[model samples]
Target: MIGRRACWGLGGLVMAMAGCGPAPAPQAADKPRAEAAAQATGAPGTAGAAGPSSTGGASSAAGGVKADEATKPAPPPESAFTPVAQIPEDLEIRLHPVEGALLVSTPNLTVVEGEQTNVATAVGVLKDGKIDFPERLRVPGWMVTVSGVHGRYPDQLDLIATGTTGRTGVAEHYALGAKGWDQRVGDAGQWFTGVARMGSSLVGLTGPTMIGRSRFVTLRGPRVGLTITPAPRKGECRGFDAEAASRYSEAEVRPEAFGATRDGTALSYGRNCNGDNAVEVWKPGEKRSTILPVPAPSEEQTTDEVRTLILPGPGDGEAWIVDRGVLRYQGGEAKKIDPPAKGARVLTASAAPDGTLWALTDDALFTRKGDAWEQAPLPDGVKARDVAVGSDGAVWVAAGGAILKHGGASEAAGAAPGTIQLQKGPPPKPRENRTLPRPGGPKCPQNLVVLYTFSKTAPDDYDFPLTRKALKGRTEFSPARFVVTRDMGQRFLAAFVPTWDLAKKLEERIKTDVRGSTPQIVCATPEVVRELKLDLKTGEVAK
Candidate 1:
């Protein structure tokens, strides 16, 4: 049963950019000098003041608002949403219908059997007929293969993604708050094959630790750790050795080992020592396991001959498995559920709360109403990749890049001034304008500079006053510094920036402030930093 109580805790805006604070007051002795410098340099205060008299109290005396008033950046433009006719149909897509919305994901590239690596670029949600992308959530260096949203509505949810970095599988959780999403990440120390949501917690299944031994361990939490245990293999095949097979490898089936039920149970599929297939039901917070045998059409059939797909059913403890024929499992029994069509292949299936079974095939959409199955209308010459059922019983289909609603209008949501609007359109760009810088900062791959001390014998003298006086009151340059120990001995440097243009400005500023001193600006972007072996903080070559 779906829990009536809402999941996911709401909090204050987590992603809001901090507003610039008021500039410190100039010293009484230097007050007049400071005003003179501001006037002479035409340096605007927090406000846009353009004249010599704009500094000091001249602006206020002339009846203008205080200079510090405008320093706060415009509240980052609220999530700008635009209506679209269809999601872009360029890549393969998957659809997940939750309580109040439909989520669309463009899966990452697959390099191995059941193993996916690399980041998933886009994630969008369809709520009230409008789609708004929360965009991609990331961990600095982890390659995220799979990600999903766990929540009851489109507006509120937790985004979770898992992937491997080096030998460890990492999970990143992005929780939505008033402003945007906040991130929490964890490391599994082992490869994760797949992820599932159980109640409020996210669970991940780990790949085998040893070459031939099958261990069914799970990685739980952005805070939870891994628990390793051998999978139950009973019947005659209980002692089957995974390493003995030269022609067929158990690695191929590893990805299919674990699945989730609607009621938050983790389902494991395996064969006993004798080769008879069975499913072990492990619910959240439970220690005992229930094994249900899967009745194969013929005893001679091997696991490879029949493909299996486990799907969440409408009620708690219910699941639908596609093995030759569609079989529904509830309580502790498995029974066949007839296909919507005589021989049409079911690519994906979703069960609605009303017991309505929604299935997507190669060329059509079908819904099982009572005992009769009927084809759902779709656009002409359309090919859909997946299907899902919302809590309200709305059937959504992912065909091409467009979302199609059964027995509903083909256009996007209606347009209102501040409400989400929709249009029959192509996929929207990542942000409003592709060329503009993001709200908080400029994008990466920019030229940066560090105020370096070239004096090998007495570098400390140059480093102290240079950083204390020349770099003070400079809000544009970064505070972090880099240090490198080369043939020239050791040197200290400061200021890492994003753009070559910005670096040049910093260079000029430093030259004017500290007479006769040369500041060296270097290109130390993430990629360049890696190639040069420059320690990001110390600037020394990484050993």
Candidate 2:
């Protein structure tokens, strides 16, 4: 069952763009020594004999209302809000939906607008068709709203917020779980673009488009670290003769290992690029690896390297290598693990974060708890290639080249395991200004508009668009930044924002037409932009 409770926990406290306080108070020009005293109190006319003085008194002598007083926000109207948050007087908060954060930029003069990372949310209810908290929760910048469908769930949400800071000696944090959400997206300023999640790590993107060099939140442990670059690019698979000739060879899979699979994070190029010896394997952003020594080849073991599969362990920096038996590597040492079943040879093994070992044999799966290995259930006729366990201890298997996920958390969940199909290549770009009579799709010029969708499953109208203004520059393109959800669903787009201010009008115009509220000014997050793959020199997406 989906969690019904509101999971609002502070993901992290981020401090970016340090020392960027207000512009140093704007220095004044030097004055002549004779007139210095008069210039100090006069408005350039030099108050000699009550020149241009106010009716009540000299303007500088008795001040009633100051200039900045006009900018002070009026008291919030009465509402049903619970907490009376002390909104910052001089801070611009930006919620990066893909990164799942609310940021405070160097004091600016615009309203806060932005996005969040997690699809999990549970905003109570919406009174009318819209959420009223926008006015209730005071933020000086854009307030972003992310809603739409993720996989099979309708993760609808509506939230109104602005961020505060530690300098103010106050902090607020929230977390949304996999449960309910109020209908409608948040206020009209910032719009949610995309989201990525791995365990508790969440990333949100909000800008010209969800594709390309867009900004996103990157969570780290309890606090949010910084945004990161997209997947690291690897040299083509045809080189590496020099690096392989000397020492340890990388793990490699056969040609048939990744048949028709176009998406892969490169591990290491093979020696001589021949792929005959060491090959790169697939693992998440983990640091664990195994290099076990094997005895002379038997009839069953044709080549020693071919049978060696380095597997990641469940704990931090743990790993194992299996060649008919397991060699556990932990604490900077590799040791042999006693076989669980009688005379049973371990074929492949996987580690869980909790340090549990689940190994595959000829017939059954042996799980090691403490010192004992016990048999665990395996679906019949499923030829397993690799086994995996999530941070939450859910078991998964790579079988027949598909990811099978088993579940027992809820009774409504599947009895057996289920397969998750990954999108192989880049998803096709969404077409815009078509004759579809869409709210935001009121027939736009083909040359002026470009639309990008999160994935193939994205709704017909749920597409993000950019115009010539957004992409203005002597530019080309590159492969987008790929961010995956917990279900392996990918959201990507290509962005080359020459000047965020230049694209402001266009971003707001579309937000008004499609969003049905006020338009929003969307600035791409600078910190998260580096995590994307950019063709900076060429300014074109790689073919």
Candidate 3:
């Protein structure tokens, strides 16, 4: 129609317009455009239409606009970021965290900070800002004991090593320092026994009993050693026979054993194999000694059996003694309180700050307020090996490997809770194979004696009130024919009885229903309850 150039330009304009509209059919769309827009936008060329104006301006402008829009993207969602809660550091004693500071103590040192470091042989945190140490001095190849002195600051530590090449002896005083340890005292003799401290003075036992008996020697200041001459003869102190000597030989006595200073009076308890069988009160200035005799059966008593005595305080004027089956409060006269039960034995005794006498029997904890005794509950799965009252009115007891603490302020005797359940199946054939049972619910097998305990919330509560419902659910009950020994029963009661009210209620109920027959209910003091390592949860006594 027109010149070739004009025709080509018109064709290019048509192709450019087509590109702005809807897409063409697939087969047709594949054909190259012959318009100028196709050339400018890099579109393919068609055969029928002449390729017009190879450089196309209009198509190029449209392509630029489309490319600009594709570059813009939507913004991210609003909740793309949020804050999270952070867990705080835990600060519990049982956790035993390494970063936190712990109080380290020895006999001479009360509370000392480790320079540039916080590490020691013994480490514990301050309870109510007070430190109480159980045992301290090292006895070389034997034992080490420390006093739990509350509100005292540990400053210095002195180590006295006593032992011989083959036998036992006084090695020397070695000063323990920040760098390490250095020898401060020298070796003296073999067969050394007692080591005690009075105020600033140190007293030790040395020499052999066969070689004119061991001597009581006192160390004054840094190096002065003075020997205490025993009374020319055994005074009014009863049961100082051969039995006492044998028992005394094994007991460990320390300087702090004499107790702290108060009105120029010194109180100490002597321990023997048969419990606290003797009490001694000495006045250093007056050289006067008052001895209290422990009650014991004549036949079972031994000359070598020493008594474990616990002196309450300077003003109490009485010492509590644990001699086998008897718990006697000895002062001016020895009067034995009836044992918690016929077969129960006293384990340990401690005097509370309020002058309450706490005694731990085999299965129960007995507390004496004036003359009346009350019981309290022990913790579950715990048998008390040692019992002590903390300054904060909290009672601490050691059972098995664990130390248990009760938070109540009441002095009444109580058991912890639940009955001591024997483990399932036949007893282990060997002692080494007898592993203690774990706490909580476990189906006990036959052949074991299972004991169930109930608490008394009110008077006239159920005494062996075994209803059809109470007895209906059990698949197996503990055998009643099994022989129960006094020691075994004591351990059972200590572990099961949680509170004093429960112990009293159980005692009354058992006695009423059993008609003075079998399975005696015994009372325990908190101290004794802790010593037996009774399991409070299952009420099972650990062997």
Q: How far is 184's C-alpha from truth in model 3 (Å)?
A: 6.9
lDDT of 2 by residue, 105-124 (tens): 11233333466332211121
All candidates' TM-scores? Answer: 0.45, 0.24, 0.37
In order, the Cα lDDT scores of the candidates are 0.42, 0.28, 0.30
In candidate 1 the C-alpha lDDT for residue 111 amounts to 24
Candidate 2 error regions (>4 Å) = 1-309, 342-347, 369-371, 377-388, 396-412, 415-543
Rank candidates by lDDT, best first.
1, 3, 2
Off by over 4 Å in 3: 1-166, 169-264, 267-280, 290-294, 297-307, 325-331, 407-543
lDDT of 3 by residue, 329-348 (tens): 43455466666556555434
Task: Tell how far residue 455 is off in model 2, in angstroms.
Answer: 38
Best by TM-score: 1
How high is the lDDT of residue 346 in model 2?
55
lDDT of 1 by residue, 48-167 (tens): 223333454875786654566524232211111122235543344455555555666544322232564544434566645455555332223333433345565646666554433332
Cα error of candidate 1 at position 479, Å: 66
